[model samples]
Target: MADHGNDPVVVIGLGRFGSSLALELARRGTEVLAIDSRPKIVQSMAGRLTHVVTADSTDLEALRQLGVPDFYRAVVAIGTDLEASILTTSLLVELEVDDIWAKAVSREHGRILQRVGAHHVILPEHDMGERVAHLLNGRMFDYMEVDENYALVKTRPPREYIGIPLGESNLRRKYGVTVVCVKGQDEEFTYAGAETVLAYGDVIVIAGKIDQVERFAELP
Candidate 1:
């Protein structure tokens, strides 16, 4: 069909998640059409976005009048009103939008959104809570779950791993994790290799199963 990858995105709702997503997209120079049922919210975002409209997202005609169907991507970020969120997502699905992302407040909401044809359902609160929990211990500098049960984590090299070349360290064999990249205290991040020696104050990003990576990070 068409290459909708770079097309402008239509974002519905103006709550924390929707507003943040729209603003960030616009800041990155991406054209964004932000929609909300409240006039004040639309007014607040008038100059901040490419286009801001005060209209009911659940109304297909209203969306059509704003040219939402012409856009390739749509995000239904109405987290509070379940009926409105579902209706908006269903309309977008009927419009055959190439990519539909909807935010869900809970697991049941997410399931409904997926059943209604939202290509992607994001539980922002749940996800953020999980991520924050992982970073709370201070052992991990950063963490991203790549897939179910798999994650990539940035952490300081374990005490025993300090001053040892990766090949000789046998990290993957011993800890069941592979160091993907390393950044020394005084050097920029670089792709790690077998001969890469990790020293104190160095940060390394490793990839492996979530439990194994957690275990490795807790090594003494």
Candidate 2:
């Protein structure tokens, strides 16, 4: 684990999501100070994290005394407890923490967190929806929108094109899309070149105008 000199991170809840994030951050060598009102919850994660405090984070003074304002950025992740989450976020802002990230259960909740000075509001459900949509859309292993007209796309090799050489297929000439890399079945990926061979289960990462990529994907 290597520290990146990030300000220590404080997580204000010990529920599934918050606990998981804290553990992951700790595993990555980031100093984490976790808090939960429930003694049992805090106790369970003790020793694994840098610090675990059993205190209500909505209390501004408690947060300040814990050195949250001076030593760490904080995340308010109290899902299902809307009031607590909002209060904690407001307190963190008042205390002037360097940065605050919050999780919201709905659009209205997100708006409120943003209005209260949360630097980032994440809607996990909404993000998961986009991931699911991409998985269901064949020819799209993963897709990131760069703009209205361009995107970076990852796709499995089209059935008819497997075993073909990059130069012979002339994918760029035919579809105006460039293959950025090819991930083969052996789990090795190489930047596209004339000598690269497409194999079964290979995934191709391509970047181009959105419509061109879509047109290319549609080819068998």
Candidate 3:
């Protein structure tokens, strides 16, 4: 069995998403137990993570031997091999791991993972596609969906709102969004206030419902 710090995350599968997530977590100093059935993959990641194991994640005995059940959180990032992905997720749920995050290749796959008790199912490709589409449709420097219908957007201050104090800009009433923070050409981002002025070169983060944000981002 692997030795890990308190509440280490168990990551099963060493594919692209799995490896990237494990590496990032390790880089951030989070204890991670990374598992992959391929010996070569496990060997390649040996020194980078807290622990690396080569074992069949779909097999309950293998998981049990590796002490996966003791993990507080687990991520199944199997990119292909749907059966392995589903079986691993089911095994994790059966072990009663507190949180299970599974990756799905399709909507149907995501639904199935959810039905089988995966706490969270992420479709990375689909999410990336949607995010890219949003970027392509507007002048936004970046856009992040804060929830189903709300978002946080980074963009250059619109010309109409420049040089005016945020309080009198009618942004909330007219555009249905609020500037949460601003970054000037030479300064770090700071919380925006009623008296904050939006200069031409300033960048701002705005928050609002998705539709309102899309409209706001479309401004000239």
Best by lDDT: 3
Clashes of each: 0, 0, 0
lDDT of 3 by residue, 1-220 (tens): 6444446799999999999999989888788999999999999899888699999999999999999988889999998899999999999999999889999999999999999989999988998898899999889889888788999999998889999999998999998999999999999999999999999889999999999999998998
TM-score of 2: 0.77
10 residues in a row with least lDDT, candidate 1: 1-10
User: What is the C-alpha RMSD, rounded to one decimal, of candidate 3?
Assistant: 3.2
Q: Which rank order by TM-score, best down to worst? A: 1, 3, 2
Pick by lDDT: 2 or 3, better one: 3
Error of 1 at 103 (Å): 0.5
- Give candidate 1's error at residue 6 in angstroms: 2.9
| Candidate 1: stretches off by over 4 Å | 1-3
Q: Which stretches of candidate 3 lie over 4 Å from their true place?
A: 1-6
Q: Pick the candidate with the highest TM-score.
A: 1
What TM-scores do the predictions have?
0.95, 0.77, 0.94
Model 3 lDDT on a 0 to 1 scale:
0.92
C-alpha positional error of residue 58 in candidate 2 after TM-score superposition, expressed in Å: 1.2
Candidate 2: Cα lDDT at 159: 70
Residue pairs in candidate 1 whose N, alpha carbon or C atoms collide under 3 angstroms: none
Q: Model 1 misses residue 65 by how many Å?
A: 1.5
